[model samples]
Target: MSKQTQETGGAPKWSGSFGFIMAAAGSAVGMGNLWRFPMLVGESGGGAFVLVYLICIFLVGIPLIIAEISIGRAGGKDAFGSYKALNSKWGGVGILAVITSFIGLSYYAVLGGWVLRYIFVSVTGLPKSSEEFFVSFTSSTGSQIIYYLVFMIITVAIVVMGIQKGIEKSCKVMMPLLIVCLIVIVIRSCTLPGAGEGIRFFLKPDFSKLTPGVFLSALGQVFFSLSLGTGATITYGAYLGKDQNIPKSAASIAFFDTIVAMIAGFAILPAVFAFGFSPESGPSLMFQTLPAVFDEMTGGKIFGVVFFVLVLFAAISTSIAFLEVVVSFAVNTFKVSRAKASVISAALITCLGIPCALSFGIWSDIKIAGRTFFDLGDYLVSNVSLPIGGILACIFIGWVWKSKNAEKEVTNNGRISFKLVNVWSVLIKFILPIVILIIFITSNPWIMNLFK
Candidate 1:
């Protein structure tokens, strides 16, 4: 928690397309891919939900990414700055996006704390029963606070270094490490006895499970998994060079993001089935089930260490992206140094996150609408704020920014064709907004629980 990085103050640019891709992909591939993606696959009925999710990625995700990034590159500023540059009235939409991301980062750090705790214990060796440990550890208020503080401190340290050296550099390192660790996990998990059943359930399509609610789940997954609706891509895109092809780069990021989610499915579900566990286990599936699976392996202690380390890498990369957006806003909007902005953002996020961290332990009894503080923050961001931000963003770019002006950035001054531009234009204007609105309406737990 005490370790720190020397800060250099400025609005730094990304080195090139490669740096941009790594940072964007690292942001896209997070715990959503590793933890929630697999659980959704099981809950939404295997490949049916995956099919809808992939459709959503192309129809919804790619178009939104291109739009947001175009806003950033054209304006050459933070999310709100970008919107203000386009039209002053739309600036509030950017503020909404930043707020949503900040809310997510608050509870997300606490989850990162959980990931860090697992990494720590996995090195020493998990106990005979990890379920018991998860229960005890989450209920220990002091330990939770310590881990959360350490996790937030590390996030702030990285953000203080600015863009190229800080985010791009860290992502370039962590993304590769995460992929390598996942490869090891995949190889080990696929070899487990009865692993084939899990693979079949993951890859084989079963359309009979399709329902209206499953479509909502798929849409929500695409939204959360790609880090859309958060101004992250817009903030990250503000560093893009004029020559970078926005459409092509956005497409590439989505491809890698979907690939990671599927790879995580291979890594987790196979192990779950092999260990005689139910695949339909919810969010706790990753934390509660994985340890038992790891414990039974030959040299499991070593693999457990690698598994949690891999997760830690994902957590850090994702948190960096979330924190970076707020930092960008502060520096650009307030004319503060990166270090100053990072310090302020970290302090604010840490204070807001205390209730979420305590939710698991001391504040468990404090509830709103039958959800704890962590769950409430998570739902507000993922369910309500994000969707509204996305809807407003789509309206701004599609109607106000207009395809004629916005498409300029995507094509890099006519380097690419205009056919795809019109397609993207139609999507953000009509299809994307409508779909996001559908998710916003149906995301209420009262509604979602009915389908479940």
Candidate 2:
């Protein structure tokens, strides 16, 4: 493989394996970890869900990460370009991934804005009523859009700086700080008087709670948390050098992402239980329930700031990856400069996000197939596009591109030794496709309602 990009006047490679791992881990670590994963653990029978989730991460998530990164390093191009380079017909799968990332980012930025607002709110003072504050903030169209734009600008500026200077550097700073903040919160949360109940609730497994649906939920969480089928791993992998070990690097990404998520649960659920709140609070757990928990804690304001800052870091880290996917596609496909692509893509995403921002306010009544714009967009990306892209990627690697070539990429063509290459091959070729398909089918409200 070449050291610099063949196209785009020699685009730079990742600074080193560590930089690649951080960037990829940043992409993998997002709201899915901070927001969704903890909620899933809360609602899905705690330790049982955690156990299934861990198993899925190894069997399914890690293998998919390996597959996506291998494809990118092998193709040495943008996500779409990489697939098109290898097989013309499989190009659409890359497009599916890219589009999924784009749509995901639209609503994702709105949530980032909410985190920013909450960060300020945390500093100012805790709200008497967390639910009312969240509702008021989200319903204020002007405020929501302004915050959304601010978040977009921040993300765009990072992408505009290019990979090493922007994404990698910011992640290096933010990820460490994020981890520290999590640790601090975990310490405080666990020390609370009634915290052990929540800890046990999160840690103790009841095998009887093991159901097929729990496994499916765990699989979906794995896909969402890892940024699988989103063109992120693939795009980041495009910038990786031949010397970097794909399997090892992918493992690091998965490990960091999973650890952050488990830590987030420790930081969150314990506090929730300590404060006499329900664990199964769903999406509002972070926005609504956590603030109330913070309200009750000693030095809660400081911890609140740290927690939201942690959340913001997670949000921005992932948002930049999402934007990079689109920007890289624009830069590579349209043959535009990085600045031009970044600006245009940022503008497009901002525009597209307008309705999503409005979904909580004036557009609240508007529904697409009984979902608000934000809900519908989230459903499509998470349930529809993500699984399709993942399934197609598995097929492309297993049958079309063939697992052997992908294995060669992961092993760096005999330079590196991967003992689990056969295991990864079998998982990618046979297991992941079936598993992700089940996630897709079970994830959909419409489809699942049919059986109900």
| Estimated TM-score for each candidate | 0.94, 0.96
Clashing residue pair totals per candidate (backbone < 3 A): 0, 0
lDDT of 1 by residue, 1-452 (tens): 11112222344578778778889988888887887787778667788778888888988889988988999888788888989988988889889878987998999999899988988777777764878898999999899999999999999888888787789889988888888899898999899889998898787777877888788888888887888888899998888877677888888899988888888889988888988887655447768788777777787778888988888888898899999889889988898888999999989999999999999888999999989989999889987888888888888888898877887778877876646788888898888889888888787657667778
Candidates' C-alpha lDDT:
0.84, 0.88
lDDT of 2: 0.88
What local lDDT does model 1 show for residue 20?
87
**Candidate No. with top lDDT:** 2
Candidate 1: list runs displaced more than 4 Å: 1-11, 43-45, 280-282, 445-452
Off by more than 4 A, model 2: 1-9, 448-452
In the range 1-452, model 2's lDDT, one tens digit per residue, is 23333323376677777778888999989876876777778667778888888898888888999899989988888899899988988888888888988898999999999999999989887555998988888999999999999999999999999988899889999999999999999999999999998888777877777788787778888887898889999999989888778888888999999999999989988899998987654458889989888887899999999999999999999999999999999998999999999999989988889899999999999998999989988988887898889999999999999988998888888889999999999998898899888888877767878888
